[model samples]
Target: MMRYIGSKAATLPAIQSIIETHASGATSLCDPFAGICTVARHFKRLGMRVETGDLLWGSYMFQLATIALNEMPTFDRLTPTLELEASNESCAAILSAAQKVLAWLERSPGRPGFVTAGFSDAEGSGRRFFTQENAARIDAVRVQIAKWRDDGLIDMLEEAYLLACLLDAADRVANTAGTYMAHLKSWSRKALKPLQLRAIPIVNNHAQNCCSRTDARETAKTNVDVLYLDPPYNTRDYSFYYHLPETLVLWDGATPTGKSGVPATRRHQISDFCVRRRASSALDELLGQSSAKFVVIHYAADGLIRHDEILDMLNGRGKAQFADLKVRSYNSRVREADIKAHHRIYWCDSH
Candidate 1:
């Protein structure tokens, strides 16, 4: 959740009410620009088959944990491979297995590797996103997870769940104001605490779901009953701001370099919707190609793209309506003052 921006969890009630008003009968939903998969999880819980994706690996991990999973994986198939006892209850069994992994991580000594060198002060890196001790723990856990999967000890679903746990734990204790764009000059209270993994509430849904990691524009051709859109509200590139999470998820075996001491990535991946000039055109193009019976888009009223521009784009295709909703978005190190923000909920019947 550290890499989250414009998440729809806060505005779920208002957005869901509007969605039911127009798309109550929809059995299939697609969230093309799914940030943290809050929309997809909502529809999935309602028994709708949902497909969602984002370009970042961190978001995809969220998708794997929240949307891709149809039921809680108990690691029953791998219990022979793993030395943990399984309980009869499905959820309890899964947690036991996860706790087994966490226990190993807790006992293991911290390894000074990618995370320690890149994101922490282990090697005297200027970045202080994590302390030397915490960074080493992260590195040890991440490396062990990778080794477990590579050694055929865990399957894809189990790996994703465990990684999500690790990332979630790290995010809470990270020494940043909110994002990993820049570390705080001094460590915060949370950063000083020892690292620990809490159980991610396993959301078990019955409907079969799928997800992708690609440009939202590319998914417009795929038709669905309801399509949810949550694009970037400004020109701030996520690849640059949340590069640490992306790298952590990737585990590319690449070390940190350069003055910033961050991993290598295409940091210039700013979306067209984030740009002032191209935003209007991009919204029009995405909405224009959508073949859903209904489309729901969440854009900030004070975002780079104006509320009227979003309305015009949606109205061009069919009947459009909006709801004014207030929410608290992430406050960046530079943009800390403007923490409280509002979004215009735009829903349309494209058919």
Candidate 2:
């Protein structure tokens, strides 16, 4: 998975403990703000039918590859059109088909195209997001995948899986310190490596899971046993931060602007939760629309929406409880090493 800002990967055990204690029998889980689909993947591994939606195309790719897909795509439709090598004896037939496809893509020759023109520093784009060689490779693989989808050589699930693999590979080689708001002034050691596409891990929970690219305002209405909320707590727009990965998802030939090379389409990626004035109201509206037996919210103590305001909103729904876990602050300006900060988890049993 990509290095997301607010991924619950580290806090999975704590979250699972809470869910087990409060919503032990939950058969379905809904995550409207499915950034990287980390939380949804956690529950999906536990055999719950996870429903996830996100505004980011990059996030939706991960959701589609890791959440919605319950089995390794056999690429049966592709076999007739393309010549794929047989899988090794150690690899299962179920997983081998996808492996062969990845191998074929890895051998794709690097071609300088849209990605090279806009994102590679060596190509005179002045953006240090990727090396010219790697950017060209990314361009080649991305365009090939899109062509396959356009020509009906690959299905939606297969296309999503391939795109997700490319996105992760690109992130590994991205010249940034986590977010792509701006690339590093100098190239990082990892950015110099050749781009390689590896088969991503596939999860099979034996449940029918679904994922969509949509606004949380509409997805909040999904009925489920457990509803998890982890909306943005600050004003950093993800579309601006991870726009490069999204370009791989959209494949739109939108011209890049400014020194950052962010897509012009990024202007439409605003979220109400990022604005201090609309943050609380947006969350309130989501809560009002949610129909879940158990609602779990993850928030930072130093968030724009105050602690009391969240408690007030949660309490109004039903019996609400909260637990605080101490963690280091995310602020780079804080010089003090001993300062204590925590993320608060509020759970409600909406009877």
Candidate 3:
């Protein structure tokens, strides 16, 4: 999976334990702000019908590829190009297929396009997001994938899987401290390595899982068993900080005008949760509309919504309980050693 700001990969076990303890009989789980589908994936792995949605196009792509998807890609047209044998375990076969596809991509010539022009370390681009060679390789792979999809050579699931691989590959070699706000002045060893696509782990449990891109407030009206919320923690807007990965998901062909290589207008990426003034009100609206029996919210120690306020809102609706967990933060604004942060898990059963 790709690196994300609020990813719950490490602490998913603890949260899942809470959910299992509180909502054991829950049949369905809904994650409206399902960036990269981490929480939804946790529930899906447990054989629950999961509903996931996110405002970010990149996250949407990730959801489609990882959680919402029900089957491993066979790549019929690109056969043996992505070799697979049914006798092998399903996951092993998928990994083999990904290996072959990446091998093919590594042989492709570097082509020029939006990625190469905008993010490459080429002189005068003012962006050092990727090495020039790796940037060109990304453009080549992206262009090839798009061509394949446009020509109907691949189905939606296959396209999504391929794109997901590309996104992860790009993120792997990006010259930053796990963010795109500003590239490091010097390339890290990982950034200097050649870009390589690897198999992205996806869940294919036999559950009726679905994904959507919609407003969280509206989605909260959906009746579900477990409603997991992990909204923006601090002031960092993901749209601005992680815009480069999104460009591949969105495929918008526009050059950035700012020195930081971020677009001038970010209307498409604005979120009330990212604003201090609107955080509480947004939380209120979302909580009021939640139709779930159990609601689990993950918030940072320094988040805009105060501890008392969140507990009050949850308690008003049902039995609210919380636990604190010390997790390492991924704040790019600070030095690597200073990125430590803590999280609070507020679990509620509004019966």
Best by TM-score: 2
160 in model 2: Cα distance from truth in Å? 0.9
lDDT of each: 0.77, 0.86, 0.81
Error of 2 at 255 (Å): 0.8
Worst 10 residues of 2 by lDDT: 328-337
TM-score each candidate: 0.89, 0.93, 0.91
lDDT of 1 by residue, 1-351 (tens): 544666677778887788888877888888888776777878788778888877888778878877887666666655566544334457445556567666556667888887887788766778888998999999998998888788887788788887887888898889987667777888999999988876566566666677788778876657689888888888887777677777878887656666445566444466897798988888778777778888888888888888878877878878789888777767654463466777788888876
Candidate 3 clashing pairs? none
lDDT-better candidate, 2 vs 3: 2
Give residue 40's lDDT in candidate 1 (0 to 100).
80
For model 1 the TM-score comes to 0.89
Ranking by lDDT: 2, 3, 1
**Which should have the higher TM-score, number 1 or number 3?**
3
Angstrom error of the Cα, residue 76, model 3: value is: 2.7
Query: What lDDT does model 3 reach?
Result: 0.81
For residue 219, model 3's alpha carbon misses the true position, in angstroms, by 2.8
For model 1, which pairs clash? Answer: none
Count of backbone clashes, every candidate in sequence: 0, 0, 0
